[model samples]
Target: MSSELAEIEGQISDIFRALSNGFQKMDKIKDLNRRSRQLEDLTDKMRESKRLIKEFDREIKESQYKFDSETTKLLNEKKQSMIKELNSYVALKKRYASNIDNKRVDLFEGPGDGYAEENVMLASTMTNEQLMGHGNHLMDETDQAIDRATKVVHETIDVGTETAASLKAQTDQMSRIVNELDSIHFSIKKASQLVKEIGRQVATDRCIMALLVLIVIGVIAVIIVKIVNPNNKDIRDIPGLAPPAQSRRLLWHQD
Candidate 1:
């Protein structure tokens, strides 16, 4: 019984450890989601900024229509302001890009012995036998991380490619101020669609979880009715009444 208790305790510890890891994974996913949201917001701001620049260009055209000679001078002033704003916006994007680059670099270079450090800490808590048995499983998690990272890399590459293609199409084909504004409008619409996609994915995840819970509750109910309740029936029988045993056996066993 002591050994059973010890094994149970170990199992429970392992379960909590798994729960902690799950929470950590949830946190990482949340961080990625937050980053995605930030990127989406940035994209929005970029589109708005682009629209503003285009509007300023429109202002130039209006000024030209009203004042032909002074139009050149007014247009130059407005154009300079737009260029300054754009440069500041590009600088902000550069900073974000740098931060992302640092994170990716650290992940690839392997930060300070990584899993080896985790293994040492884990080893301190277990007996040699337990460590030997579970060590392979722990190592397997490293491989899983690599696979997940590779998947993330591919996804990011796809996003980059799409973004580049959209930028190329807008810039190459839409040089006029009106056309540029339309392109910015198109980008905002695209962002809204992406947000809807994210919402749908979240809803899908929640529905699957609800279904799983219902399935588990149904299974437990069936087990209680079939196995647990029958055992409890004897306990519920009154002492004054003949024990249910002989009668139950006879009822079921009779040909």
Candidate 2:
């Protein structure tokens, strides 16, 4: 009977040992499962980060491409406008110079042949001093003709001088106008450059704003997903179930 009791006791001890070992293995399996879940969550977070980075890269590239296209278009427009204006100014200057030249030529031209013919007729009609007595009268007529010719010559010289002075004044005015046109051209160029710079800055700012908006939207989406799916406890929820602070900082830095 004692041997039977001892055998029963040994069997009970073996059963207990086997049960303890089973419990330990079950605990170890549970721990392994928890660690695996954590690794999976970390992997998901890493994937999300990679996806966001790719999105940001794509957005930045697109923004840069848009800015470049707009800048090129603006530059072309400005160049065409400036060229047209300069051409107009040049044409005007040419027309004015041509008109001035024509007027000068007309004003300084020689007298007609009618005056010469009249002088020849008068000389023919004059007697060798119809009598030496009329010689003085012929001399007086000759002197009067000389005086008239001198007066005509003097008047022509005065007219020519006045015309020359007028031409000179016009030339000086044209020169001044040309200088003003040059100044205007320079100012226009500067203005175009400034506008280009401002446009670029505005484009850059818009890009930054778009990036910020995307980041904010992403953050909101993450929050909504966390709130809607209670079981989906992602590592991103560590900071009050919001997006990672590092991501926000990165977005700011990109901006």
Candidate 3:
């Protein structure tokens, strides 16, 4: 082992030793306040131990490449053992803490809160192991409840994220639909304008055709008058509808 890792492991071992001795002291200490203080000190030691473990982990990661695979595997196993030891101490701390709290409550309860005579009688009859077992069971249930709540919260967050995405997709679709509707409306409006323009063009064409008809009819009347009175010099012959000339008409009359 490297010197740095050795020093870290020593510090961690010292903290664990202190924690084990503190927990042993807690058994004889009847004063709840003193026990509470001892647990607090042990808790601090546990924190330091955890910090050292993290340092150890970092050291292993930094130096594992220098060692063979077997050496590296041993190092990892050592870390896991330390973690299991720390967890046992943590469980012990929780057990003692619960015992102290329950004792405090039992000491100061009012009559209305059901500090019943039979319960105290039963507690007196029960052994320390039974009480500890019951407390452990309660702690386990509480931990399980917290785990379930955490799972439910994560699931709810996932569902909410999916719902938000779906809503966004629906909103985008609606926006596209509205845009298409607007385009269709604009096309209809343009078609209406074109129809109006065509109607005006057709009306103007009909008026021009009527004017042409009137001119053709007037020319035919003038030609008929000229034929009836050939001497009228004021009436001129139209190119296509009137007689060709006085000479052509005289030839026809002579024939």
Candidate 4:
């Protein structure tokens, strides 16, 4: 009983530890896309750990019946503690996500702000050819940034689609398992009723057989008593047991 909860608890702790390390490492990753991907991985790990915690809670509930009150209370307390830890991580993830989004917004808008000021200064001091060349370079950089953002968006979409499909498959499988369990429960109930009916029929049959045997024994006892005491009239006068009476004298009797 303890073994099951222990395994899940250990897994949750490991995943949480990994998430912490991943977040720390992500801080050092300067590329926006790489950091985003790293964050996604840690998010996935956090999700797994959340699932493990839920499973652990369910396991505790299932085993609670076997535990004393104090033990059950202690288990509940532990579950709450794990939940708080998970929530703290959840908060940390949200904070990091917000920060990333802010950075992304700046990445897109910051250059425009700088260019606005630069254009003013350059327009006053540069030659027409130099101005054209600088404009072209700025355009090229903007196009590259757009392309990178587009690629990141596509990757995120693909990941989301795959995750959705996997979750749906798991949901369907769980539904089938629950349905199978319900059918098995019904079958067992029917079998129990059938067994009870068979037992009743057997009991009734035994009672009838016992009655038949007693009746046969009673008849044999009466016959043995009559033979042992011939003067007993119980059967002596019975027409079938008596010696044939002398044939009634007939009008034409033969000697």
Candidate 5:
């Protein structure tokens, strides 16, 4: 009995150890589940961030288009104004040359004192000064128009550059988030594998322990039956080895 009790206690200790290992595995499984949930949360957050980044990208594109359109319109307006000024300057020059030719003809062909020639010279001088002024004004306006157009072009280019940089930054950040999500997902998977492996090991140990205990109990029962009646042939002859007196009583009762 002491040996049996000792054996039982040892088996119980082994079973407890196996149960502890199983509990450890359960703990690992729980930890894995928690990490999986965290990964899912992070994935959801990344998806939301990606959605916002897409919206930002769309806004940046729209802003770039508007800037391009406005800048082009401003440049075209400046070009048109310069073209009109150039055309006006050409016409004024032609008119001034025609007036000079007409005055020279009058001075040579009409009968007048030499004072007519002096008046003609004065008229030519005034026309020349006016033409020079108009030329200067046209040049000044052309320069100003070109400067304005250049400024608009540069501003448009700057806007485009900023938009592109913002888009690139958004893309890079999204990529980083995706990478991080993948890493977390992988860690969750690894943890799950470890939990399963540990659980399998614990279950195998428990099965072995149970089988050993069952074998030990069977051996003890066999030893006890053999010790109770060493020379009991009639008892051994019964289907399950009933003792001699017990079988005799059973037969008498049936009769």
Candidate 6:
């Protein structure tokens, strides 16, 4: 009985150990779940970052386009204004020259003192010279303006090219980030699968452990029953135990 008790005690100990192992595994599973959630959060953050990057890229492109459009519009307006000013200057110069020619003819033909005519002719010549100088100055200013405008346009184009290069670099960086995200997603998926597999294995182990515990309990119960019911005829006889002999009564005969 003591031996049987010891055996049962051992089985109970084994059951306790199994339960401890199961608890440990459960803790591991909980840890895995926690890590999985953390990975999911990280993935969400990465995606958000990527979205922000794309938004920023779009804004930059829009700003660049707006800048280019405004610059071109201003340049075209300035060019047109310059052209109109030049045309008006040429028309005024032609009218002034025709008026000076008529005044010279009248000064020569009309009755006038020689000194007065000389003064008139001299004044007209001085006016014409001043007009010519002014026109030359206007031409020089126009040429300078054109050069400056061309330089500005070239600079704007260079800036645009640089901006495009920068955008390309940013796009490349985004691509790299996307690739890294893909790899991270793959890793997370693999980890989740591994966790699931572990859970399945643990469940299987738990079921096996429960069956083993039931078997142990059944064995202990049978041993206890056998120990408690000594009169059970089904119990096997022990070696060296003989059957009881029938007693014969001796009677004395009367004479």
Best by lDDT: 3
- Cα lDDT tens digits for candidate 4, 22-69: 878977999888988988898898889888988988998889888899
**Candidate 6, clashing residue pairs?**
none
lDDT values, one for every candidate: 0.65, 0.60, 0.90, 0.86, 0.61, 0.58
Please give, for residues 1-255, the per-residue lDDT of candidate 6 as tens digits. 234333433443443344334333433543444534543443343344334334433444444544577654553454344345334433543454465456567667765454676766765777777868867986998899899999999999999999999999999999999999999999999999999999999999999999999999999999998887766753224434433333112211211
TM-score against truth, every candidate: 0.29, 0.37, 0.45, 0.45, 0.34, 0.36
> Which residue runs of candidate 3 sit more than 4 Å off their true CA positions?
110-255
Model 1 score (lDDT): 0.65
Task: Give per-residue CA lDDT, model 2, range 1-255, as digits (tens).
Answer: 134333433443443344334333433543444534533443343344334334433444444454577654553454344345334433543454465456556556645343678766766887776545466876898899899999999999999999999999999999999999999999999999999999999999999999999999999999999788868765555557565679968866876
Superposed by TM-score, candidate 1 places the C-alpha of residue 117 at a distance from the truth, in angstroms, of 18
The lDDT, on a scale of 0 to 1, for candidate 3 is 0.90
- By TM-score, the better pick of 5 and 6 is 6
Better model by lDDT, 3 or 5? 3
TM-score of 3: 0.45
Better of 2 and 6 by TM-score: 2
Residue 176 of model 5 has an lDDT of: 100
**Once model 4 is optimally superposed onto the true structure by TM-score, how far is the C-alpha of residue 215 displaced, in angstroms?**
99
Put down candidate 3 lDDT per residue, 60-99, tens digits, no spaces: 9999888899988998999999999999999999999999
Model 6, position 125, has a per-residue lDDT of: 70
